[model samples]
Target: MFPLGDTHGGRIPPLNQILQTVQQNTDSLKTYISAHHEIAYRSIQQHNAQLAMFAEAAKLQSRGLEQFLVSQEKANLHIREIVGLDLKALAREKQAELGKEEMEKREPMLRNYVHALADFVEVVGGRETQSQNGELNVAASVATIKKAEVKPRVWRRG
Candidate 1:
């Protein structure tokens, strides 16, 4: 290779050679710095994109939760409407009316039930305490005698 400039007594390079080396180093440093800057910029943009996606997901979740809460509140209001605002006051207001209505509705059914229960008891009591013309009534099993003696055998473990 042909030398661009000779070093004086091999102690110091020429001024032009020194300047060229410095310029090359400076150019490499600039290139390296620019490459790193581009990488960092791209990384920041990707992070922002990901953050935006996450934010949108969070917003959707928040909206869904809000809708759920609204529905729950509506359901509570509907139940309150069905049940009334003050149950104690309502019960107090309806006590006499409900009692009279319930008694009127159940009186005939209760009477029939009592009559049926009395008839059932009478039939059951008559069957349980049966008498045949003032004579004693006995079960056939109790009246029959066992001519053959029954002996229960005990099993022994061998």
Candidate 2:
């Protein structure tokens, strides 16, 4: 009953059906690959846009900080000049007060007034209030009032 050398009986697959199945699978794979490529391209574009925005914001912040530092330096210089002028005015006032009649009788009162004013300035101006040991350095402040004078012991308290 053997015809030639073929071992298959009669269940051989049709060539047309096999080819069609292969074509359908290939088409499905192509569609999926195209969609994936489009999505990847769009994601890259969005990321690039976000990166550009971040870079611009950082540049603006750097500029703002530079401006602030410049203004702060100018303000500090102005404050020092103002304080110098105030000290000179206070010295003039003290001289006038001491020149009055019977100066010796009111010397104590005038000294107290000057000390009070100095302490007020130190507090209001937010200057350092403590000495080397955390105690109030009233004399140190008074010494600054008379910059030319060299009598340190006379002004020191305690």
Q: Give the top-scoring candidate (TM-score).
A: 2
Q: Tens-digit lDDT track for model 1 on 81-133?
A: 32233323332344344465553554453344333433433343333232321
Give per-residue CA lDDT, model 2, range 26-125, as digits (tens).
9999999999999999999999999999999999999998986666555544443433445545544655655544444444544655556455555535
lDDT of 1 at 152: 12
Backbone steric clashes in candidate 1, count: 0
Model 1 residue pairs with clashes: none
Supply the global lDDT for candidate 1: 0.47
Please provide the root mean square deviation of candidate 1 (C-alpha atoms, Å): 26.5
Question: TM per model?
Answer: 0.49, 0.51
Per-prediction RMSD in angstroms? 26.5, 10.1
Which ten residues in a row are the worst by lDDT in model 2? 149-158
Can you tell me which runs of candidate 1 are displaced by over 4 Å? 1-10, 85-158
